[model samples]
Target: MTYKLGLTGSIGMGKSTTARMFRDMGFPVWDADEAVHRLYASGGAAVAPIAAMFPTALDNGGIDRKALKLALANDPEAIERLEAVVHPLVAKDRENFLQKHSDSPLAVLDIPLLFEKGSEWQFDGVAVVSTDADTQRNRVLSRPGMTEKHFEMIHARQMPDAEKRARADWIIPTDTLESARAAVERICNEIVTDA
Candidate 1:
């Protein structure tokens, strides 16, 4: 049986970098954000449903993310409505990935909202990439087009780092690449050994 590890962290917590480390270590990694991007691409499974719900958010043959963001911001309940349409499709995509990687010794699902969406139960273990609050804030704010309000909005949607750390089977601190890589190696060694 493949050991399914759910990898998660709030925005700017270095989750993507950690996911890459896992991939580099020869573990099959399924990225939820990438899946969503695929689903929102032209002719993707989510296009038709999302188009029907938010016509203006469709550009050419695909969903325009910026337009969709604006639409959601304009409507107080649009996010919930949008999630109602997209979550199941994302779940299906994830399931397909798991099926494809079923033979692997270990599989990592990189989901930013793993805990927030209550999907932690699907994984054998959960690893949370984390850093101090100041580091997280500084990292996020350094990105182009990221404002304080936007950061706050995104931060508010995520579970607190403390809570996530408490729930995690392993906490990988991403303050430094060396530290994060060491943790990844340790986790891989431990899991593979146990298997």
Candidate 2:
């Protein structure tokens, strides 16, 4: 049977980088963030439902992410409405990805909000990538248009990294690139030997 691993981390914690490393190690991966981008980009099936909910935030059958962000800022239900339209589509895509790699010994689902969304039920095990809070804050602030308030707001929506670590099967720390890579490689080693 294929082993499904759920990988997650708070924003700017090198989750994407770790996911890439897993791919380099020859594991198939399903990235939820990329799935969301696809749903917002050209030819996305999510554009219609989204446009219907917030007509002004779409153009030519695609979502204007900046506009959507502004629209959802103060509106409590806008995010809920948006997630309602997007999650099902992403879930379907994820299911397809899993089926395609069912023969593999292991596959990874790189979901930033796996625990927040209670998505771990579908996985065989979970891993969390982590960094010190200051490092996380600095990394996030370095991004264009990311303000401290915005970072705080995003953090508010996520489970605390400490709490997440408590729940992780393995915690991979990304203080240095080489060390992070080694930490993840070590986890892969554990996975192979655990059985």
Candidate 3:
């Protein structure tokens, strides 16, 4: 049986990089962000429903994230409505991915909001990628078009890094790339060996 490992982290904490490391080590990874991206793309399952819900969010036959953000800007409940439309589709996509990779010894599910969404229970184990607050702040601030206010907004919505670490089955600290890679290697080996 394949062991489903949920990987998560706040923005700029190196969750994506760690997920890639797992992939490089031959682990099948289902990325929720990528799933969402595909769902919002043209010809995706979410496009039609989202279009019906927020017609102004479509751009060139796809759901435009910026437009969607704008649509949600004024209404406090808009995000909840959008989530209602997209969440189930994303869950189905994740289920299909798991079925497709069922032969694997282990698989990784990279979810940015794993804890917030109450998804931690679905995984056999959860790994939280983390970094020092200063490092996280620096990394996020360095991103193009990212501002302090935007970072604060996003951070406020996510569980604190310390709390995530406390709840994690494995804490993957990503202070440096080398350290992060080693953690990935170690975790992969441990999982494979135990399986």
- The prediction achieving the highest TM-score against the true structure is 3
Report the candidate with higher TM-score, 2 versus 3: 3
RMSD over all Cα atoms, model 2: 1.6
Best candidate (score: lDDT): 1
**Error in Å for residue 147 of model 3:** 0.5
Question: Residue-wise lDDT of candidate 1 within 1-195, one digit each (tens)?
Answer: 899999999999999999999999999999998988999999999999999988998998999999998888889988898899889999999889889988988999999999999999999999999999899999999999999999999999999999999999999999999999999999999899999
Please write out the lDDT profile of model 2 over residues 53-157, one tens digit for every residue: 888889767899888888898698889888888999999988889999988878899998899988788889999999999999999999999999999999999
Instruction: List lDDT for all candidates, in order.
Output: 0.94, 0.90, 0.93
Count of steric clashes across candidates, in order: 0, 0, 0
**Alpha carbon lDDT of residue 12, candidate 1?**
95
Off by over 4 Å in 1: none
Candidate 1 collision pairs: none
lDDT for model 2, on a 0 to 1 scale?
0.90
lDDT of 3 at 23: 93
Would you list the clashing residue pairs of candidate 3? none
Residue pairs in collision within model 2? none
Off by over 4 Å in 2: none
